[model samples]
Structure formats: structure tokens, C-alpha cells
Target: MLRLKSLGIVSLICLVAACENSGANYQPVIDGPVGPNYDIDLAQCQSLAARQGAFDSTTGASAGTGALAAGGTTAVLNNKGTNVRDAAIVGAVAGIAAGAVQQQQNKAAIVRNCMRSRGYNVVG
Candidate 1:
């Protein structure tokens, strides 16, 4: 069980680390003509967003929490031949998915907000 849990955590970490920050593709709707430094500013903001979105803290936290919760619940409900490891893995996967989605949203928002702060007039 310990080995299985450790393997799940390692896999989750690897997946999170390999995820690409979607902020690089953010194309905000500019209300008017862009400044001369628009491309540079956008690139900088995208880089910042990517760095910020590199690793979401909630991913590990939620994975651990979900694994424990699911394992405990499964053990309690299915006492006979209960596969707690499988349940834990499922829970961890779900947590990872949720965290990844939130991280992507955060990345996009970061890009958008950073552009707006730099006077880009992001209408979208």
C-alpha cells in the first residue's frame, strides 16, 4: 500500500510537471491599436504566467487529501477484499484533473490581467 501510494504521488508529480502553461496562446481582444512594445509586453506577461502556473500547490494537497479520503471510505464501506489502493488512485487522479484545470484557468487569467495592467485595453 505504501509503495502504491508513493508511486501514485510520483506519477501525479510527473504529470503536473509535464503540463504546458496555456497562457502562451492567450489572444486578448485589443480595443485599439497596440503600442510598439505590445509583442514584447505580451511575451513577458505570458512568460510570467507560465512560470506562475508551472506548479499548482493544490495539486499535491488535493491529491493527498483525496487519496486518504477515498482509501478510508473504501476500507470502511468495502471491508471484504477492499482494494483501497485502486480507490486511492482514482481519487488522486480526479484531484489532479481538477487541480490542472484550475491551474490552466489561473494561467489564462494571469496573462489577461497582466496585459490589462500594461495598458493593453483587454476587452475580452
Candidate 2:
């Protein structure tokens, strides 16, 4: 009975080894543009940034004009005019910079969608 049990154990080990050595045939689906999709997303983000910048500039110009009209020369030389305009310009520049950074992130999402549509596995 001991000999029989030993033989059974050896057989089980052999079977497991064989299963481990079995080959699997797998084909991955290739999808989407082979390159980074940053260009398209960057363009979109730039457009958005430009729009925001224009809006900020217009608002700043209007505020500066109002300040000038209100306080005359003092407002023109002091915080009322230049300060508000500078703040608006800075805000516009900061917004554009943020938009550009966001574009990179958005590009990854766009690339993922494109790849999914073509049936490729997106590495998380």
C-alpha cells in the first residue's frame, strides 16, 4: 500500500509538471494611432486657452477704463488702473498654462478611448 501511494504521488507530480509546461497561444489586438495623441489634445486646449485669454483681456480693459474714468490721473498712476490690468493678464496667463497641462491628461484619455475602440488592452 505504501508503494502504491508513492506511485500515485509521483504520477500527480508529473501531471502537474506537464500542465505547467503546456503552451498557450495568445494574440493581442493592436489598436489606435501608434504614436502619442498629444497633438490633437494640445490644439484643443490651446483653443480653449485663447478664448479664456480673450475674455480676461476684455474684462481687464474694461475695468481699467472704468478706474481711469473714476479717479482720473491718480487712478491711472496707482493700483486702480495698472494693478487690475496686471491681475487680469496674470490670471489669463495662469489659466492658459493650466489648460496646457490639462491637455496632456486629456490626451491620455483620448488615446485610451481610441485604443479601446480598436480593441487593445489599455495598461492602467
Q: Which has the greatest lDDT?
A: 1
Q: What is candidate 2's lDDT per residue for 7-123, written digit by digit as tens?
A: 644654454344321211112233444446544544443343333221223434454444445445443567575555444444444444334334444444554545455445555
- Taking all chains together, the TM-score of candidate 2 against the true structure is 0.35
* Candidate 2 lDDT: 0.42
Inter-residue clash pairs, candidate 2: none
| Per-model RMSD to reference | 3.6, 28.3
Clashing pairs in 1: none
The models' CA-based lDDT, in order, is 0.79, 0.42
Q: Tell me the TM-score of each prediction against the true structure.
A: 0.72, 0.35
